[model samples]
Target: MSPEEAPARRRGRPTGSRAGAPETREAILAAARSEFAARGYAKASIRGIARTAGVDPALVHHHFGTKEKLFGAALEFTFAPALVVPEILEGGPEGVGERLARRFLSTWEVPEVRERLIAVMRSALTEDAAAAMLREFVSRELLLRIAAQLDVPEPHLRAELAASHMVGMAVLRYVLQVEPLASADPEELVGLVAPALQRYLTER
Candidate 1:
């Protein structure tokens, strides 16, 4: 272990350079992601994730509090909310759509995140529980938060519209892999999608 990692180990923390968590928490998150991807949110269990992480189920709960919180936290790290949220919030309401579009699409640019997101999206489509979990997480974490920050009327509806646009793009570009859109350049896609998102949040 490196000198910096040694102190963390001595204090019983797992060591990793991942943005969130020490070694153990990262391990749990990794396990959760894999489990969620493979089993879908409806079928995935804390016990299964714990088993994969080689930790006790209680340890998983202790780290994450609840399953909703755990999945949300895991998604947050994969989505890089900390890095993306502030960028979206900056520069006021002007051109926020482009920023949101760029940042949102950027999340899928990563191989790992994209792969897991696909499986999770599939689960959401086929499973009611999975759909609820995803709807709540995305709305609560990304869409609602962004819309509220802009002081929009009917923030919930606006958030859903923005999310619909973004999600539709994701389904075509990443999940369904539709032609043209799937092969399109990132900036081109951003330009094509941003206007709709802008109107959703900024217009009415």
Candidate 2:
């Protein structure tokens, strides 16, 4: 090899030297969440997220492939509720209402879950992509799980009704913080709300 020939420039892009792929991916996700929050999913761009993350646009594409998938990853927190929902539904159908209410309210009362949900809800209000992702996840995962367990006419409708009431209660208790509803004991709230949820799940 002649000295002027030069050692071939190593191919492709240089690897990130400090963080491994997983850490860089996480950084991208964190930046994506912030970008989506600030700009909403429709306006949030791969280049913008990459800029916020201090990584190249190609890295974002390399990790997530597209804006849609990046938005989905940004909203990954929404999936955690699915994990707890089945546990809440696990008992005999008899007092499922009370169990569901107790568990649902209890779970969201945690600071982390409450804050995360508030952020998702805020994003969902303004972003069609955010709304679609959340709506699809809940309908398919949470509501349908309960509906499938019921042996009732129009079980899907029944499950939806039950979910609606719980959702309203959650909004009031956690989001709106409405008066006594927000401060009411979980047991007391269960007493007031569970019977209606029970009727929805079992009746007709």
Q: In candidate 1, which residue pairs clash? A: 14-23
Off by over 4 Å in 2: 1-15, 18-20, 34-39, 43-48, 51-55
Candidate 2 is scored at a TM of 0.76
Residues 120-203 of candidate 2: C-alpha lDDT, one tens digit per residue: 777788878788988887788777787777878998888888878887887888889998888998889889889998888777
> Looking at candidate 1, what is the lDDT of residue 134?
70
- Scored against the true structure, residue 56 in model 2 reaches a CA lDDT of 73
- lDDT (CA) per prediction: 0.77, 0.76
* Candidate 2 C-alpha error for residue 44, in Å: 4.1
Instruction: List the lowest-lDDT window of 10 residues for candidate 2.
Output: 4-13
Q: 87-193 in candidate 1: lDDT tens per residue?
A: 57667778988988888887888788788778778777888766787777776677656656766788778877787778788899898889988988888888988
